[model samples]
Target: MNRKELFEKKPRIKINDKVSYCPTSAAMELIGGKWKSVILTHLIEDKKRYNELRKEIPGITERTLSLQLKQLETDGLVIRKVFTKKPPLKVEYSLTDFGQTLTPILTSIIEWGLRAAETKGEFLLDE
Candidate 1:
């Protein structure tokens, strides 16, 4: 499908009298977890295999990665692809077209984080 059609099919919030709860709440529901946004940040650059994701994301357990990926897939923000032609199966994860629309929001957050780190002296994991 074309870009226009893809955008048209994306989930959107319609504002009307029938609407309830804050729109921010809806966003949080999809990306509120400790690891959801982190996972998304890693995916923003390119599609990554499961092990590649684990290696890139520090402190993430195998179980957490699996669960978060499953949730993201269910929420229509991520696509999971599996290849099974060889001895070891390969699984890749990428953002859906709708998910790519979140680039602005994610980019803003990343910028803010870098600014904060400037004063905070950065965060480093203990070795």
Candidate 2:
């Protein structure tokens, strides 16, 4: 490609050339969907089977859960394992080491949500 064409296709702005628009945007891009963070938080606690995750996270359609899990696996945040040695096949999901890096952030988010819920009268802090 010619220099002019290349420059036109991608500007010289290093920041914009990056995958994310900004630092916060990068974080959001990874886990900003309706249930991405929720799923990640659950995985943080322990590895869970697909059905277990579905039961833990209310109102998430099976399709959405499957799609989200695929996306998470693609993003290297979660690992999916399949076991086929038994009569019924089994699958499980868990966070990878890279995904574990988000624990502090997810914990903070959970704490913030709890406090917000208390203020909104949806939960009691004392309880």
Q: Which candidate tops TM-score?
A: 2
Candidate 1 similarity to native, TM-score: 0.79
Model 2, 1-127: lDDT tens per residue?
8877865676333332347534566667778889999999999889999999999998999999999999888888999999999869999999999899999999999999988888885953564
* Candidate 2 Cα misplacement greater than 4 A, ranges: 1-18, 124-127
Tens-place lDDT per residue, model 1, 9-98, is 764544322332555656778887899999999899999999999999989999999999998998888999999999688889999998
lDDT of each: 0.85, 0.86
The alpha-carbon lDDT assigned to residue 59 of candidate 1 equals: 98
